[model samples]
Target: MTLSPLVFAALIFALVVSISYAVLVRWLPDPGKERLAQLTPGRGSDHSTLWSRLQKRLLAWLLWLSPWTAAMSGGDEETPSALRVRFGHAAWRSPVALQIYFTCKTLLTLVLPLIAWALVEISPWHPQGLQRFLPLLVGAAVGYYLPDWILSILVSRRQRALLHAFPDALDLLRVCVQAGLGLDAAIERVGREIRQARPELSDEFALTGMALRAGSSRAQALRQLSVRIGLKDINALVSMLIQADRFGTSVSESLQVHSDALRTQRRLRAEEAAAKLPVKLLIPLIFCVFPSLLTVLLGPVVVTLARQLIKPVG
Candidate 1:
């Protein structure tokens, strides 16, 4: 029942490849994430999705595997408010998201190093001590930070979607306000109106309206919205709304001004990105494309010149 070195190496390669593919899939932002969040009710564990169920099972297994891992798995400690707020910005406010995230991190952090160590033990290199542990350490580092990287990516994408939706929302709010609905009513109406088109932004507005109805002050609720979103535009909009309300200024006019400003900023961002495109492309243009083109066009010429300059003794 012993495996040969070749078999062991093959197993290691297969394990690494499979794990990498799984991580790639796991890291991708789910398109149906918001929809799932909306439909899946109840607390902590979201039994509605396959991924969530998998996370729950994995967590249970981790807690059973090594009791000490509880701290690493986030099972023993209370979820941090900062992490919760960060997830909210990523449109993953459910308790299940926190569970899934920490579970994945713990699983990968523990699994990867073990796999790396097994490979190193069988590896032919045979580094004495410190060098042998290098790969394992590298694997551990990547595993620990992978979830954080994925979360940031999710936050960026959700922010982009919300940013695009903001101007339309401002217009709707302006219309609602000018039509004499109070600012609170306007938000609720806009939330309902945009639910079909911009569901994520709509959800935030709906929550803000609910908070206001639940006796939270206008400033407090608006600030909460800005916090959850963690977007500068929303933060500015919240501050503007609060100031307009506090000073008894016309809300409609403020909304109109802010809406125009958002549009202008969006255009400027596009132009700035376009301006940077050539500079960004230069690296690949020089390193990747030029080398290949030079090889194709000048490789034969160089070979010919070398042959001519150093003729073989005949």
Candidate 2:
């Protein structure tokens, strides 16, 4: 088959575009480096410690890749060392890792368009040569940022999963405390008990426990937990815990009450969604189902009427 000029041009353009995308990907920051930098202690006894050395190597490799990352990650604003230290606790490990892991997914936005183009090119149904450029352009644009968009979706899903498990975690904590464990012991117990069912929450709880054991205050650990999840429910729970601690209230009672409230709120949310189901269904019924029903029910009558009316007119 003789190759057309337009097809030849598109193939060349795709090659150049793919190369540019690869360069852009190489220039993006490695999330693992940012994570390590945030988690590393600023100054310590051993600057040559194994983890510290590893972090340094990672940072060096990351910085080597993109000179822009240093600029993008942070600017000249001088945050206190103490304040920067707190950021590690606030960052949700999953979301950051999520963004890094799926950054390459953006390339998929090109797949459908490329496939369609190839199909049209080979098949007898091929359109005029000039029309082929449109799909390729749209595909490239969509594919270029698909990864970033997918990462956001993943973050949302992870957040929802955390929220779903939170009430159970609170209930477990309440039970542990009611069984005579102290607040710290109760938190540890809850973390251990819910490890399988609510691993994310369990991990956060365990981290809080670790921080507490490492000499941080209970309030500080709880605050960190709230920040890490970045969830309103976690914030409310932390606020309640803080108040209970300050006011000498029963911790178990406080947890139990919060758990009950969370459960109630979840139930109410489910009911609200169920109530909206009919409204949500209406559009589909009008556009799809209703039309199909009318076609099926009235189709024969219309055909018969057309035949009778036409014979009389003829």
Please report the candidate that would top TM-score against the real structure.
1
TM-score of 2: 0.62
The digit string of per-residue lDDT tens for model 2 on 1-314 reads 86775786687679879999986665545556655655776843332355557767764554444343333334336424432333333343442332222223333544757965775666444556777677677676677666546545655676777888888888888778888888888888888888767877788889989999999998999898887777788799899999999999999888888888888888998999999999999999999999999999999999999988788643
Cα lDDT listed for each candidate:
0.84, 0.71
- Model 2 residue 95 CA deviation (Å) reads 12
State the local distance difference test value for candidate 1: 0.84
Clashes of each: 0, 1
Error of 1 at 128 (Å): 3.0
**lDDT measured at residue 176 in model 1 versus the true structure, 0 to 100:** 92
User: What's the CA error at residue 284 for candidate 1, in Å?
Assistant: 0.5
Residue 72 CA error for candidate 1 (Å)? 4.9
Scored against the true structure, residue 65 in model 1 reaches a CA lDDT of 53
